[model samples]
Target: MKSLILHTATRLMIGILILFSLFLFFRGHDEPGGGFIGGLVGAGAFTLYAIAFGTDLTRKVLRVDPITLIALGLASLVVSGVIPLITADPFLTGKWLFLEWGNSDIKLSTPLLFDIGVYLCVVGFIVTVIFSLEEEN
Candidate 1:
C-alpha cells in the first residue's frame, strides 16, 4: 500500500493531469499539441493512480473497460472518415459545422472528431497494456 502522502499527492495530480490532457486535446486543432500527446498524458495519470492504489481500483474508477474504449475509438474514427463520403467528398475530407451562439461561433469538424478518436484509441491501448502487464506479474 502507498503511504498517506503518496496517495494524497497522486489524487491531486490525477485531476490536474486529466484537465491538462483535455486542454491539449482541444487546443490541438489550432496549436501544436494534439490527440496523441493528450492521450499519453491522460494515460499517465491513470497509470500513476494504479500505482498508488491498485490496478483493480483504477479499473473500478474508470468504470469502462479499456477494450471498450478501443472499440469506440476505432468506430468513431471510421465514422468520421465515412461522414464526408455522404457529401461526395473523398475519404478523410474534413467537414465543418458551425454553431452560432449569442456572441461567438463554435466550429466543429471531422478532423476534430478524428483527433478525439485517436486520443481515445491511444489512451485505451496504453492503459490496457499497462494493466494487463501489471496483472500478469
Candidate 2:
C-alpha cells in the first residue's frame, strides 16, 4: 500500500522529468544542451523510481528489459549514423526532415532522433546499474 503510493508518485515525477529533459535536450541543440546531459537528467527519473519502488516494480512498469532497451538504442543510433554514410556524407551529419502542414512547416532532424536514442540508452544503462547496485546491497 505504502509502496504503491510511492511508486505512483515517483512514476508521475518520472513522466514529468522525462518531458522536461526532452525540452531541455531539444532546446539545448543550439544553446548549451544536447543528448548526453539531457539523457542523464531523463535517466535520473527512473533511477529515483527504482530507488523508491524496488527494481522488480520498476522493470514491470517499464515493460522492457534493460538489455533489450540498450540494444534497441544502440541499433537506432547506428541506423541514424548509417543514413549519412549511405548517402556518401560524413558520419554524424545532421539530416533534416520537413513537414508541411497547411501553411506551416514542421522541421525535424536526425539529431533529435539520435538524442532520443541516447536518452533511451542512458535510461536503460542507469536502470541496469541501479538494479545491480540494489541487488548487491
TM-score of each: 0.96, 0.81
* Model 2 spans with C-alpha error above 4 angstroms: 1-12, 102-104
What's the residue-level lDDT of 36 in candidate 1? 92
The alpha-carbon lDDT assigned to residue 81 of candidate 2 equals 79
Lowest lDDT sum, 10 consecutive residues, model 1, at 1-10
TM-score, model 2 to reference: 0.81
Lowest lDDT sum, 10 consecutive residues, model 2, at: 1-10
Candidate 1 clashing pairs, residues 3+ apart or interchain: none
Candidate 1 is scored at a TM of 0.96
Report the C-alpha displacement of residue 18, candidate 2, in angstroms.
2.1
**Candidate 2 lDDT tens digits, 1-137:** 25877767886788898888888787776788777788788778778877887778878877999877788889888878778887899998999889999999777887877877887788778878888888786
List lDDT for all candidates, in order.
Answer: 0.93, 0.80
Top candidate on TM-score is 1
Best by lDDT: 1
